[model samples]
Target: MALAKLGEGANTGCMTQTDDSLRDHFLVASPYLEDAGFHGAVVYLCEHSAEGAMGIVVNQPLEITVGEVLDQLDIRRERPDQPVYAGGPVQTERGFVLHRTGGDWHGTIPVSDRISLTVSRDVLEAIGRGDGPRQYLMALGYSGWGEGQLEEELASNSWLVTPADDDLLFRTPDESRYAGVLRAMGIDLNQLTNTVGHA
Candidate 1:
């Protein structure tokens, strides 16, 4: 499965705890997480288990557009312009698509009842023909945590966990998503601090 391929090169030696999976959740970067790559980032978890966690950063859109990517890959395009997100710090050369689940694709991993992750070009080809998933977030690369890395970070309060919302994930504006999640949780931005607090 495409999701299993995510751990192919990882050597974190993390356990595989399917029952404790955090799949389909959102990882909102806490203010205390000062890493330039993740500061104020909003990640949608695609797969999470004891082996590790993998997700896509949905709030950071690159200047490059879907049209540009299609042109670069020589895929015909009939759709309107769409921004491509910078998914994470790993595998930046590869592309990943998070879209509303429906059509069958060659390389697809279901993230939830409503979302699936596709790493093959066939979906892009379909999009080029105006027949892809109705809503999608196209990105390059993806955020990943090996072994217990994510747990340690969570222990240190680096991320605010929240249930994944389709409206926030697919329909919310990129710039507003970070605060939108907070708002949905009734959190005031000014109240956020390094101190641990449940979302």
Candidate 2:
């Protein structure tokens, strides 16, 4: 996985139009996907193009708190302790903010009409002051794929992609996100198998 600074805005050069892009979608790891980093991961695709795709693993929470991060950044902690999520395997030290679109912030990229991705410090500052977007997820790092890489994985059935919903992204519990996505797709987890078959 290649990691880039989210604060630099998205790298759109490599992106090309496909029949349909997965932006503003949810990628649920298939049962056959054995990569420890992605197993059972439910990623929210913020950007996708021929250049590649970038997303955050919404279900994996690191053993850190929002208050701790604010303290480290010297931002006054005014909110209660919130769990910080592990976005993905790339750039573990970097941060990405996934939130509802409305608040103005530096380096904010609208993923869709309803959601946005921001990496600037100003949003974090606002969050610390309780004036940030009403709904936000603070993630450290993100998942990235090279051009055509994500499509290849999709062809191999490594992921089950679905349109994202606000409930799944912001309201669902992290631990149940993977299954919740599957349920939203009308798939039962108990009946799923590792075998991939073609007609």
Candidate 3:
């Protein structure tokens, strides 16, 4: 399985909430975040901890299609029209599936009761056969941060954090996801400034 190469480092672990953890949240890239890959991105954070953080860029679709991936793995595509996502900047070759159903698949990690992340081929096989979770997004690679790295970025006002919503994750159009999230938070993009002042 190509996903097995991700190894134990990719495990999502149990869904444990901490005062500092951003798990099950959305990280919206601030306009000040000049990184081209993350600019205007809406990231679904799957894990966050004192150790680090991991997430998928939910709104960036690659040119590749789900059908192409199924063909590569020899899995018959029951639904072939979905686009694959560029999950993050790290491990561009690895694949991760953010799904909305619980199943005992290999390398499956629970993000929440309604969401999970799976890195094994069995889930893909099931999707090909129309037997997988009801809704899913397949992404290649994921965004990650080392200990204190994300905190430093947060302190720098590089991102805007919001509670994750299923509608935003699965229904919003890719082109507008970043703006949509901001709107949902009652924020006007034009009103935001690059400079954040401390009280």
Candidate 4:
């Protein structure tokens, strides 16, 4: 698959939430984050509100394949080689599919006009039958934050927020999404330092 390069946009330095909703945004883990699971992760925020936040880490491809997952469920696999991702730290046994909007699946949440997140088995059934969305990533688990948790992290510079792009979410290779999002936001990954600026 050709990795589409994202177009450059304003270099808005590290962003902290104001009043805008972060749903459908990209949560790029700061380089200094000490958590091993999230290092270099690019999370696609599916739900973000005053109560809490939920997202799936899109760039951490596990050694497993979608076929492997379906096989465990006794579902037939037509696309066996597609890589699966380690979505986050919660519910590792559960599966989540981040795909382009086109199917009528149960438990589907529209993340954006073009993207949706599905947790129901029917989506997987359709995929096993070779009738799923053309662009999709199957992941196990998802990142989550409690009320005011994400905002605290944002205030502490633990993450950088940017508008999520479909190509970056669906077209870019899993290994390249972190840098891809940084590039799109006019950020040079090498130039990012761990030092937090204080006013």
Give me the overall lDDT of model 2. 0.82
Give me the runs in candidate 1 sitting further than 4 Å from their true place.
1-17, 193-199
Error of model 3, residue 142, in angstroms: 0.6
Q: Write the per-residue lDDT of candidate 2 for residues 1-199, one digit (tens) a residue.
A: 2233543444323344466899999999987675867888999998788788989999999999877888888888688377889999888888888899988786677788999888877788888898988898989988988888999999878899999999988998888888888999999887665343422
| Number of colliding residue pairs in model 2 | 4
User: What is the TM-score (0 to 1) of candidate 3?
Assistant: 0.88
lDDT (tens digit, per residue) of candidate 1 on 1-199: 1332221222223234497788888999988675868988999998788778889999999999988888887889997488999999987877888999889877777777889888777888888899998999998888999888999999878898999999999999999999999888888767785344545
Alpha carbon lDDT at 184, candidate 4? 99
Shift in Å, residue 45, candidate 2 = 0.5
Which tens-of-lDDT digit does each residue in 1-199 have in candidate 3? 1133322334434534578788989999987676877878899998888878888999999999988988887888877668999998888888888889587787888787888889878888888888887788989989988888999999878899999998888877788888889999999877764343421
Q: Which 10 residues in a row give candidate 1 its minimum summed lDDT?
A: 4-13
**By how many angstroms RMSD does model 4 differ from the true structure?**
9.5
RMSD score of candidate 3 (Å) = 3.5
Ranking by TM-score: 2, 1, 3, 4
RMSD, one per candidate, in order: 4.5, 3.1, 3.5, 9.5
Model 4: what TM-score? 0.86
Q: Distance (Å) between predicted and true CA of 171, model 2?
A: 0.8
